[model samples]
Target chain A: MSLFKNDSDFKMDVLREVGNIGAGNAATALSTLLNKPVDMAVPTVSLLPFEAIAERVGGSEAVVIAIFLRVDGDAPGNMFFIINREPARRILQGLLGFDAAENDNYSELELSALSEIGNILAGSYLTSLADFTGLHMSPTVPSLAVDMAGAILSYGLLQFGTMGDDALLIDTTFLEGQQEAEGHFFLIPDPESFDKLFRALGVPL
Target chain B: MTEGTLIKVGMADLNIADGGAMLRTTGLGSCVGLTLYDPHLKLGGMAHIMLPSSDIAREGQLNIAKYADTAVPELLQRMISKGAVTGRLLAKMAGGAQMFAFMGGTDTMRIGPRNVEATKLALERFEIPLVSEDTGGNYGRTVELNSLTGVFSIRSVQHGVKEI
Candidate 1:
């Protein structure tokens, strides 16, 4: 709560810029991977309650595929690449040239392929962010899971749980051909990391 | 009455239900969903605990329901106000799964087990017996507790509905 102290609007704008830059590169990576144009919406940064956080993707009980990774370095945080089941199946079938099953169950190979895709997109995102902020941010190996959106996204919020019931998240949505929603990129920096992020970017503390 | 009503409990929250109402918390991963029930009074309480201890809290206004140590007592107090006796209270918990397991990873995200252990320790302070639990897996769970019958049911994506 005090993390914002004041100047929350300005701080949110700064965070929105951060998301814009990071997700821009990720969308570029996805475009290259799929050999098609991928458009990303303007990033939104908000302080959301724990329940509403899951509503961003779908609902608490909505099952989806998520690739999670922990970012460690100057501005440590959690990152997630979440996609709906239909888009995941499409990516597998269209990009990798595999007959992705229509059923709910995903094959091990399909999962790994999706993980690798997340790795590349997240890598591009972090690298660009690190370059922009001049801070060293590295991502752990990505882990993939297909489960309830609340369950998967809640893992990213545990670090923030100690501070308050609400968390600040930078969310960016990706659209394939500017029509079909593909996935979302959520960047939730730890509670303490906001200071470091602000100082690094020369925003007034 | 009619069928039991589902009183949804969000993360970092707790609730008490009675009169055949159901206490439910959804999408619990690396967090514990603890339910305390009094069979005689037909009263039940559920807290979706996110952390193991309140000592780690750095917020200005401490949310007691978010941590195991504080939530257990808070939920008990609420149930007691609803005419439920501590002696008659029994616990049934689920969730607290490791969700994502990495090699040589710190206990950061692996806090599911610690949440369970802390919740158990908190229950010990009241001398309330833990009747059953469905915890410590590598998946997610949505659990519900029936106030009338004290029936704790756990539902997961990997495992279908199972009652404890």
Candidate 2:
């Protein structure tokens, strides 16, 4: 709660730019992977209650494919790349020559390929943020899961849960050719990380 | 069977129901969904525990239902206030899942198992029996408990549906 003592509009604008630079790079990476132009939405920084965070993607029961990466350097945080089922299938069909599985069960190869894509995007996101802020931010090995949105997203909220019922996150959407929402990029920096992040960016605490 | 109210328990939340009501918590991953039921009174309580202990909590106003250590006692006291006997209370639990696994994992990464262990320990401290449990998988689960029948149902993506 005290992290954003002021919760100032100026602070939110700073976070928006941070999300912009990070997810913009990630969208570019996804575009190169699919060899198509990918459009991105303006990043939104919100301090949402725990339940509402999951609702952003869908309800608690909404099944989705999530790639989780633990950012492990200065200004540590949690990064998630979440994709809906049908869009994931489309991505698989477009990128690889294999027909995507029709059911929830994904072949091991398919899962690996999806994880690799997530790793590439998350890596690029962190790299860009690192360069822009001059903070050494790196990601651990990315982990992938196809499960309920609440469950997957909750992992990123544990740190905030310790602080309060609310969590602050920067959310960005990735769109494919038709402007259909293809994926979401969620950046939930740990409660303690915000101070370091703002300090690094020359924003007064 | 007559229709009963369905109480939705959100993340880091808890509730108690009586008669034929159902207590449900959805999409529990690396979080434990622990329930307390008194068959004689047909009363039930559910807690969606996100962490093992409140000792690590830094929140100014601690959410008792958010931690395994605190949720158990709070649920028990609520049941008691509603005239449910402690001796008649038993526990059934599900949803301590390792949703994602890293190569070299840390303690926080193993939170699912820790939550299960802490919930069980809390029940132990209260001298309640853990009759059945469905826990510790690499999957997310939605769990529900029927207060009237004392039946616990666990639903997951990989595992269709089963009762504990």
lDDT per residue as tens, model 2, B92-160: 999888888888789989999999999999999989999999999899999999999999999998788
Taking chain B only, the TM-score of every model is 0.97, 0.97
Model 1 CAPRI quality: high
lDDT of 2 by residue, A80-166 (tens): 999988889988988788779677678988899999999999999999999999999999998999999988988999999889899
- Deviation from native of the Cα of residue A172 in model 1, angstroms: 0.3
User: What's the C-alpha lDDT at position B136 in model 2?
Assistant: 95
Candidate 2 wrongly placed segments (more than 4 Å): none
What does candidate 1's lDDT look like per residue over B38-114, in tens digits? 88988889999999999988888999999999999999999899898999999989988888978797878779999
Which residue pairs clash in candidate 1? Answer: none
Model 1 TM-score? Answer: 0.97
In candidate 1, stretches whose alpha carbon ends up further than 4 angstroms from where it belongs are B1-3
For model 2 the local lDDT of residue A197 reads: 85
Cα TM-score per model: 0.97, 0.98
Model 2 residue A113 lDDT score: 90
